[model samples]
Target: MNQKLKKQDWTVRVLQELERQYSPSRWSHRMSADDVIKAHVKALKEGTEQARDLAQTLLNVPYGEGDGEKLDVYIPKTNSLDVHLVVYLHGGYWQFLSKEESGFMAVPLIDKGVVVVAVGYDIAPKGNMDLMVSQVRRSVVSVVQQYSHISGLYLCGHSAGAHLAAMVLSTDWSQYSITPQIKGAFLVSGIYDLLPILSTYVMEPLKMTEEVAVRNSPSKLVPQLKLSSSSCQIVVAVAENDSPEFRKQSEEYYKALEESGLSVTMEDVANTDHFNIIEQLVDGEYHLTKVHR
Candidate 1:
């Protein structure tokens, strides 16, 4: 076979393998995948509703001029000088969820005087991968600028959201006016490399090409990451029951960060799948939630 045909053949085989490995719902050990997702969404909605009632929320605050470039900010009831802000990115394969269901994790954090910002970005079918990544990066910059008085800035994301958070960490902040002082990051069940996604149905709506995937892949962008905050801590956590590919990506990404001399750790949360792994963030006592605090 010619070079071009050989490459195409390899791509076909990789895609077939990824299709099985990347399908989280298929590997779910809990209830049916659909039921698990439904329960997860319900939890997110209820938790966010409770968070709104508990905190002084600033809803739909625009970070950029675009309609989807808005975020929901949850502020603690008691004002303190030592405020920590956490920017959360929701994951629905970069297409499904929205900020409306993103603030669930704030319920526990807010009571402890942590400000949580649930970011809104244009998801797939409407927004491309590049645009989503840019929006997330810009949202963090906007949050940092808006809350300049904040003592610490942190980041958290689930699945696709985690991917975006990683991208934000690997950002070339020189393009922006201010570089955010990110203190810590929590990445849960995320996809670090996008090449495998190209062959999966998940990429159908996002329409990412090989070059686009390569450019946005955090696993590939570790060299460009500006680790200005030597103390910045990155926790790459994977669900116990997550698909093999998901765990592989988190492990690989953690290794890459460790090799780069960045402060990073890997967490294998026990007895959890992709959906519940993040849904548990609503619980204050959850292992990952405790780490967030």
Candidate 2:
């Protein structure tokens, strides 16, 4: 085969394999993709609403100049001299979900005196890969700046949001005025490599090229993470029922971080799939929530 033909053949095989591995809904025995999403959205809505009433919330706070560059802050009812802030990034394959429905996890955390901030960034068809990454980085910077006296800073993200959180860990803080004192990170069922996504149906709205995928992939940025976030403890968690590919990616990324001498651990949450693995964050007694506490 010619060079072009060889490339075409490789792409075809990759597409087929990746489509099966990346289709998280197919591996889910509990519910169909639609049902899972509906439940996920309902949990987010109810949890966020409940959290609003329970906490001292500052909603729609802008972190950047962009329209979508805003975050919702949830402060605990009982003020404490020492406060730990957790910034959450929601996952909708980078095309859906917003801060409004992202505060569900805050419900349980606020009761423990943890302040939660749900971050917002422009999703696909409106924002490109580079722009979203930049916006998230700026959001963290803004958080550190706004809360200068915070005792510690943490990051939590799910699925695509996990990818974004990993990217944040690999950021070059010298470019920004402030280097966030990140204490730890929770990455749940995330897609660390974007190359496989480029060939999947999820690529339609994001419109990422090979170069974009390569640059944005958290797996490829592990070296930078070693330099920038070596002190930050990272927990890379995946649902037991997640697609094999998701587990593989998490394992590989954890290995990479460990090899680079960064503080990282891998968690395989039992009896859960992609959606509920994170949705259960609303429950204070949940396994992951306990881990957070």
Give me the candidate number with maximum lDDT: 2
Q: Note each model's CA RMSD in angstroms.
A: 2.8, 2.4
| TM-scores of all predicted structures | 0.94, 0.95
Residues 216-274, model 2: lDDT tens digits: 99999998888889899999999999999999989999998889988888889999998
Worst 10 residues of 1 by lDDT: 223-232
Q: What is the alpha-carbon lDDT for the whole of candidate 2?
A: 0.91
lDDT of 1 by residue, 1-293 (tens): 59999999998898788887887877778888788888888989999998998999999999999999999999998757779999999999988989999889989998799999999999989999999999999999999888878998999999999999999988888899998888899999999999978878998898899999999999998877745545679999999999888999999999989998999999999999999898888899999999888
Q: Count clashing residue pairs in model 2.
A: 0
**Lowest summed lDDT window (length 10), candidate 2:** 20-29
Question: Clashes in candidate 1: how many?
Answer: 0
